[model samples]
Target: MKFRLLLSLFIFSIQHLISQTIDKEKLLEYYESQRYADAAQYLQSMYPSDTKDTKSLTQMAYCYMMSGKLPEAEKSYLKVNSIEPENVPVLFSLATINSRRGNKAKARAYLSEIIRLDSLNFNAWKQLAGYGENADERLKYLKKANTLNNTDPDVAYDLSMTYRELKQYPQAYEVLKTAIAADPGNFTLQQAQLPVANQLGKYREVVENGEKLLKENTDANVINEMGQAYFYLKDYQRCAALFKTLEDLGVRNEGTLYFMALSYRELKEYDKAEIYAKKTIDEGISNHTSIYYTALGGIYEQKEQFSNALEAYKRGLTFSSSPTLYYRLGLLYDFNLKQAKNAVNYYNLYLKNKPDPEEKDQIEYAKARIAALTTTKELVKK
Candidate 1:
């Protein structure tokens, strides 16, 4: 009986090898020609999918992936994963597909499994690092990745950037130096080095290195750092010029504008200084105060909270007597609160502000209401 079973198993193995050889030849005709869609079709037709081997399923999945048939690829990979649960390469392929599909949690789970099986797996750790939700979590994963492979340019860049985001400037600077040394012609590494160098008060180094990097397409971060470096070096004229370039690029932020203002002042350009100082305040705070309050009041009005709407408008008047606020207050009192005297007073205040040409309808309404309310008050008194 044992001899019969052994002979039957050998016969089955020989048949399977013959079938696999024929499939491989047919598949290579399409696959070697880079016709992945054709190869996927051929692979899927090889046998009933329910009986296909895991190796054949994996090959089909790879063809599907190359052909941009993500759903088909995912299904094939899933079947392979179930059959060969301990296969690391299959796990990695599953993670890649899930990530491409925006299934971040599933991708992370597969990556976690890879590391559990082989803790020294560098690609799994690096890919897992990006799944972290916060800077601290990202920093922890990135540190692990960086340790596993310090010479990896991408890992070094990400580690340095995470350190910089957390205000660990010295560590950020050090990481980039090692990566840059390994790949000296890397412009991205050079770009990242500027801000940390400036933060560490290495102004001369930032300027000397930054000047060679300036181009039509230089990033705004690099320009901002160069502006700061020039300012600290007391090169006021060049500082103002660099900030002006940022302004032209539409990259002006509050800090850059404030520095621009100071740079102009140091260069004895008072008018430009005043202009930039006003811009700094507008960018930093206060300029949108009235608009913010107006939107808040409108939200309250939408919720049918008339009292809250009135209060929001009144508070906005205290910040800036924006004509729009006066108009809103008048509308709430006139239509909702039934306070004729309060409505009339606010309408008159709104008219006195002489709002813009766009407020012509509002101005006309205010004028007509004031006249009607004043006459009604006299009649009530009588």
Candidate 2:
């Protein structure tokens, strides 16, 4: 019985040695040719599923992955991971396979294990960020990833985006700045920084970086950013010019028209301001038409054009009865136009909208003015 057991053990040892001794040149040739399926098959024929050879199993799994036989690859990788439980590459491969197969929970599990084993794993954190269920969760993962390896451009970009979405503009700007410094030639990073700079009131920085980006690509977003920067910088001429280019390309939206109107108004060019103001109203969304009119009225009011402001507010009432517009109309009539009865009518309209709590001061002023306007006392009584 002892002799028979020894013979069986020797045979098993020999079989394992022979399998390991097989010429690997053919496998190399297959890999060199990018014939991944052939490589996988070659390894599988030499190494059985129950083989204890981790190297062979890992090689087979990689080939299966490259050959697009994901199930086979996953199985092979699982075997390798069982043999070498701390193998990060094996875990990463499993994570990738599960992610591609839409098994997010499994993918996240693998990634979490990787993070638990190697807390500074930058790619693991980045992957977790990608799998995050919401913006805040994404931000949490991305911030960790960025801290792990801030020089990684893709992670930097994603982290910057999450920061921007959370309205954490300063952090977004800092991340993007570091990333752009690391990868000066990445135009996407360059373009992304424009809005962050704008949000932080870094108007000159927006103009500087934005101008450089535009020279490379005429992105409408970059152009708009430059326009906004120029407007805030009080460089109204350049602001109008940039938005005009977007308008000429027929890519103009209400924001474009609004910016153009404001630019011209700031430049004391009332006719052009009115033109863009009308364009803004034309692009007004349904049932929200009064918003554009209010903006237009504001532009005229800022320019001390009281009659035009009156015209704008009254014309706005044709589309929708906006409480803010009603209040503005009442004020104009009470102060500028000297029509107390007209003022009281608009005050009544303003009161009926039940303005938000934020507008309590405006509401109180309207009520006091209504009571004090003696010429409208008869109208108020009726």
Cα misplacement distance, residue 175 of candidate 2 (Å): 1.3
For model 1, the run of ten residues with the poorest summed lDDT? 9-18
lDDT of each: 0.85, 0.86
TM-score of 1: 0.80
**Local accuracy of candidate 2 as per-residue lDDT tens digits, 306-351:** 9999899889888877898999999888887778888888898899
**Candidate 1: residue 98 Cα off by (Å):** 1.2
User: TM-score for all predictions?
Assistant: 0.80, 0.69
lDDT of 1 by residue, 15-132 (tens): 3632544444455457557789997787566556685477667877888999989899989988988888878998999899899999999999999999999998999989999999
Prediction 2 global C-alpha lDDT: 0.86
Deviation of model 1 at 317, angstroms: 5.6
